[model samples]
Target: MSRYLFALGQLVARRRWWVLAVWIVLLVGAICFAAGTGGKTNDNFTVPGTESQDAVSLLQQRMPTFSGAQMQVVFATPGLAKVTDQQVRAEIEQTMAGLQGLPQVAQVVDPFQAQAVSPDQRVALGTVQFSVSAGEVDADTLDGVDRIAGPAREAGLEVQFSGAVYPGFTADIPHTPEILGIVAAFVILLITFGAVVAAGLPIVTALVGVGIGLTGILGVAAFVDVPSAATSLALMLGLSCGIDYALFILSRHRHNIVLGMPAAESIPLAVGTAGSSVVFAAVTVIIALCGLTVAGIPFLTVMGLTAAGAVLVAMLVALTLLPALLGFAGDTVAKFISPPLHPGKAEEVARIAAYEPERTCGHAWGRFVTRFRIPLLVLGIAILAVVAIPATRMDLGLPSGATQAESSTARKAYDLVSRSFGPGFNGPLLVVTDLSHATGADAAQTLMGRLRQESNVAAVQPGGSGNGMLLIQVFPKTGPNDSATTDLVNRLRDDRDRIESGTGATYLVGGTTAANIDTSNRLAAALPVFLAVVVGLALLLLTIAFRTVLVPLSSIVGFMLSVFAALGAQVAVFQWGWGASLFHVAKAQTLSFLPIITLAIIFGLSSDYQIFVVSRIKEEHTRTADAIASVQNGVAHSARVVTAAALIMFGVFVAFTAVDNPIVKPLAFTLAVGVLFDAFIVRLTLVPAVMALIGNRMWYHPRWFARYIPDLDIEGAELERRFAHDAEVEVPQGITGVS
Candidate 1:
């Protein structure tokens, strides 16, 4: 496999010019098409395949008019006084009238009307009910809200509209991930490679890979419901790593060329070494992403499959298209681009950096590592341990649609209603009485009475006269995370038999909390599957790379620990209120998909760093019998590259946390922190420490396994044989190159 990769690298280098042209054209065309043709979907709650979703579906059938719409508007004066202005009333009436006339709107209540406002009159609230549509009513709702908001806000009144339209905010999120990711990738590359063209390689390669992935996803969404917005984040992340991985190898190859090696010899040498590492990294990522399949949320399942597909595509692009571009661009990429960035000695610097240093006093960096390896390791481990402590407090919950748009009109109105009425107004429980046995009001009343007695229940309204169901309002004593929410759910299920015994009907409980409970249950059931797939795949890759069982097994253990630490930090920030006030955010009802999504992302990215580091160490071990020397050489070589790359990747990932929406914020933030830990702690310190302990035993393969497996040229002697005798061995001087 390594020989074939090297040969492919050589072949591409020979015909680099044409391949580069083709890649550029294909990428440009794909980007243009994706801008218009690529479709989008939401990434929120999924049907749990539980009784809750079933109940919701059944209720929808019985009550076809049930539109998942809730709207709220608050009228607050500077002094919290009532608005008695006739103009305000007139404008409010006009907005309500406009909203009522919207195509799917079932009803719109005016706050000035008798039942809509509270008795005290300090606050006014309105509700807009919708008729269930065949598809999401986002477009119509957003349009109507915009029209209403325009005139409503123009009236010198503060009005907010939130509801179904809130999902549209996510619609634009997917479009700019690649763009944001590209900008981030470039800035990081500049810092790492210290050359503009060198930095451009990763950005360009990522653009090409992501463009193709986008087109592929657009093709797939036609057949399934791919409404998860996190797909954008996943794709961008995949592209960035994919292209950057190639950049790592290609940059190394260019260094060989500057050393006066022939293009044919240099390309293969680069591939025989770094290409093997890239493959290992790619496989680990694919395995980790596949882990999401165990999650079972259709949203998460699709994310798993699609994200894996994207990573696979990126790998192929990196191996083929990227090398071709690098080969064609040749010394010019590093040469012309490196000049202005570094004075006049760019080539000299590249040469000197490429020449593997033996042992040196070096500088402050070396002094610190040599003098304080133990203390630095201890300090790093302690910080990770502290962060991991928060995982004990982590609580997973699906984010409700109401929270999607914090500033949406409907959410604002809902908040107003909740503040003035009760917490139950923000989230209501749906009670479904089995119509087969009891079709009368008496059974409904009995169910309602039972629900009201539960601790979380603030009020139990017998399904209003229209829906012929029971509607219960649950007001948590403290907040959404209050034990009352969970207790209410348990109480309803616990009383199921008694509620139905005499009445001949069972009640199904469905609400935000109920849905959340179902989602949590589904994830728990699927977690084993996710872990099995991820670990199994990662082990397979490790076995293939090191030809040993222990190599992959150890890697998996370390990967899991790093991921747990990342999740723990997320719990502290989102669930524990560490950074909530920074952005005017509230403590989440529970940890959102951030942790799960972070798990998948961190798994893939961390695996990328691990592969690079381990592959380098393995390469060194094959060349020299001294295991300690191999460890020192590999760490010295790959640590800077991994750290610099991680810092750049961290910048991109961290930007997501700054988004206004709460869902992606934590997911992105956790991604940044997780990747940072993976690169610095796991890849650099923990991996080296463990490998040092294992020594040459880390590379031991059972004799029988070796006989069955075909040999690959990635074994160090092959690379040395190919490039060691090449006459172009003049090492350059000046700035150190990426190799």
Candidate 2:
């Protein structure tokens, strides 16, 4: 793999202009294709094979009107007032009249007639049934509902629309988050490289790669059922990995230039070594992402595969485009605001661009850490364990209106309903029963009686009946994300066989609330299987890549610490509401996919940091034959670049915490902190301490395993071997060069 990369890098250097042109043309074509035939993204929440899905299918077949996108147009006033008063009722009825006339509105039920008014009569909830799903509702149609409600607003009633229809969903997601993240990344890169050209090159390459990937996603979304969130995930991963991958390789090439290696030699050497690590790291990430399918969840499968595709593109860009760009950059990437690294010294160039170590700050830290290896190891584990304690109480469930931003319209409606009706009014479970063999009234009464016996049941009322199918609506005493509601759902299902056997009726517990419960239960059941497939598979792959058992074992342990630490932070902040006021966020159930997604991505990053740092140390250990010097020299050389890349990735992810989207905020926070702990504490601190304890035995591998484990040659050993015999020369210690 390294030899192929070396040859590819040399080829790119020889054809730099052609390579640049091809990338430019490809990028342009992608832009044009997306603009010409771009498609909108829709969020698909349906979990196949669940009771909720079966109920929806039943509704679509028998009771079509009630099956479509349903929401409440809530009108609220102070407790002293009643919306049913003559004047308020008149205005609200007029507004409903206008809503009925709007496009895609199938029907509008009047609050007074439906008896949907609250006990205090201060809040009135009217139903608006749409002809199509929420995703198909035009933005103009949703806006028209708001626009036509002027009469109700004028009558002193606070009118609000509910459901996904209110958001007026659009494909034009705001670019502010991406722009902010990129700005932060550029600042960190400038500090790391200390040159405008050097810093800007990584940023440019990252933007180019992300631009192409994003456009391709948009273009393909026209023909594919791509979810809106998938694009965000793709953009985030693509940009973060692209910048870090390019930065690592460029950092290597910059040092080579400083040592007076020619551009031709330095470029290939950088690609052969650093680029190989990038590929291995990306493969691990892609594998973990693809493993999401093992959960047997469709939407999650889409998200994982989509994110993995972006990571793959970023890796390829770093390997191919970055090298070609470096060929043109030469010393310009390393020589700005200071003397150039190489001052035109081609006369006495050495054939083998050997590994040179300097006594830098990383070297000093490595020596100190290894000397106190036991204490450092204990301290790192103690910090992680302490942080992970919060994860024990973490709540994992779907987001509810109660967890929405306080100022959001969804929260307003939820609060108004809860204040007037009850908290459970925001989440009502629907029971759909088949009354084919028995009388409709008898079957409906029997099912409602069974539901009424449930401990958490607040109210059980007939929803509607049509075509031998009866709908029963049951409201819980607790909120949608409450554990009590989950228990009620389980109890209902447990009694399903007894209830149906006695009445000749078949039923399904469904609706948004019940569906969320079912989805959560499914995810809980699958989490273990997901971890086994993704983590177990990643371990085996790492074993093959490194040809060592202890290293991969250490990596998995570090991975757990990083991911759990991040989840603990999320639980404390988002779930426990600790420091919530700072972000203007509310306490709620953490996003259900947060842990799963975080684990998969972090597993990849852990592998990346482990391989990049350890492989360098292993290279020096092989060359020097002294474990202590190998640790010191390798740390001196690789630590700076590793630290810089970690920080850049951290900056990119951290910037998304400020986004208004609730789903993105927790995930961004998790990834940001996960990267920080994994890179700084796990990679830099724990890894070296363990290696110190193991001594030279850290590199040991059984002969049987060694024969099967193909050498990736990520250390550039093959490149050096080929060059050394051709023309080896010793580089004097004091030799220096400048552009």
Clashing pairs in 2: 340-739, 343-738
Q: Which ten residues in a row have the lowest lDDT in candidate 1?
A: 358-367
Query: Runs in model 2 with CA error above 4 Å?
Result: 169-173, 338-357, 498-502, 723-739
Top model number, TM-score: 2
Q: Tell me the tens digit of each residue's lDDT in model 1 across 89-173.
A: 6777787888788777766667666344555555666656566432356576766666776776666667765443332444455
Residue-wise C-alpha lDDT for candidate 2, range 1-739, written one tens digit per residue? 8888888888888898998998899889989988988665766577888989889988888887777676778998755778878888888889888989988887788888677788888889887778676667777888898798876787688997665456443335578889998998888877666677778888888888898888888787777667777788888899999998898888878767756678888898889878888888899989988887777777788788888888888888888888888888777865644435743232112111223344355777788878998999999999988888899997789877787667777888888888877878788888887888774547667778877887888888776677888878788988888899888888788889876766888888988888888777778788888888876877788887778888888998999999999999889999998898876778989888888898899999888888888888888888887787777777766777788889888888877777766777788888998999999899998988888888888888889988999888777777766654345445566544321
Clashes of 1: 25
